[model samples]
Target: MSNIMETSDNEILFIVKSTPGNRQREPTESDPVVSTLHNRKVYKGDTTILAAEFSAKSSVIIEWKKNDFTIYKESPQYHAGQSILIINNVQHCHHKKKYSVSVTDSKGRRVSSSSKMKVRRDSGSKISSSSSSDSDE
Candidate 1:
């Protein structure tokens, strides 16, 4: 059998296979850029909506915060959505508060932006109250 295998008339076949190890690539995302501009202005007893937008290569989760605290969705006072945040009634309590939106990818990449709300008195008077967490504006 060995001599027959070695001879040209009889042949034996052997097959081998190899594969390179796969390398995992790190997740990447661009800095979250807020598309919503123009500070919203709403008088007392009026509803106002704030919207923000951004793009990323991977799936991302979005959130809205007021003064660094997470806002609940569809709450009586605050209505939060994937891209839009709504304040039911503009009131003194919300004036000049820092409102921010953050986008976080599944890989833990995160970016955020913030702005202050300007709540005005419904009465036609120049006297309006303003407050802020910091004196940035």
Candidate 2:
């Protein structure tokens, strides 16, 4: 339990009190709050990260997918702490693709969000070579 008090100078103070057999409270079967999915554009061969943020008091399951294919669902790739999906050294193959994340709580409550990834060609690369010699008539 906690109490809030106001001083004469308009300063607020909080006092926390503990009781016997008191434990932390947990969320009760409420739908998870998920962040809005935003589209991203990046240059080819660039590193980018896709994050799926959510809030829940209980244990939840998270899954990351790309074009209906599963990814980062296991260890070394799945980061449950920050709820983020990482893509290193992005390439043209990742362009114009759909990425999504789904979260589910123990009570069967679920939430999901998806966004499209757009890739652009690098400006520093040349496509063709120019010749110095010209035709004479």
Candidate 3:
């Protein structure tokens, strides 16, 4: 497969579909860019979401992992129809490690849609509290 557009850290906007052995249609920014993975490179203590999208004729597979541990694979997202993978990593947080994801076609040819799994140590946290009875007293 050919990379019609350079991968971007920003949100993707378009994808090109071509006939076999023909130049794929160059998608303008207006075309929908389907993604099978998001935040592919997440850290152990970091919690994020994974998601993707596709058309009626397109299919995808998502494989995610931490180190050598396989977290997910060839998984179907958003039921068995439109492709989407939404993964909340908060419950499965492990030792700080880089997460990986691989996306492919039904025939196993890969498409370039990778991301950085990053964790910020000092990003701070949100604390919620009501008026404590002990403190109120």
Q: What are the Cα lDDT values of the candidates?
A: 0.45, 0.49, 0.34
**Against the true structure, whose lDDT is highest?**
2
Cα error, candidate 3, residue 111 (Å): 2.1
lDDT of 1 by residue, 25-80 (tens): 33245443334434445566654555554555455566566677665321111112
The alpha-carbon root-mean-square deviation between model 1 and the true structure, to one decimal in Å, is: 26.7
Which residue pairs collide, candidate 3? 35-52, 41-117, 42-117
- Writing each residue's lDDT as its tens digit, candidate 3 over 1-137 gives 32222221123221221111211343232332334333333333333443333322234554445554544554343212222223332322332344455545555455434433444344222211112121111
* Cα lDDT tens digits for candidate 2, 72-132: 3422222123355545445666445777777676676878888777666773232111110
Pairs that collide, model 1: none
Question: Best-fitting candidate, measured by TM-score?
Answer: 2
> Candidate 3: where is the Cα deviation over 4 Å?
1-46, 54-58, 75-95, 123-137
Candidate 2, residue 50: Cα displacement in angstroms equals: 1.2
TM-score of 1: 0.55
User: Which regions of candidate 2 fall more than 4 Å away from where they truly are?
Assistant: 1-28, 74-81, 123-137
**Considering TM-score, where higher is better, how would the candidates rank from best to worst?**
2, 1, 3
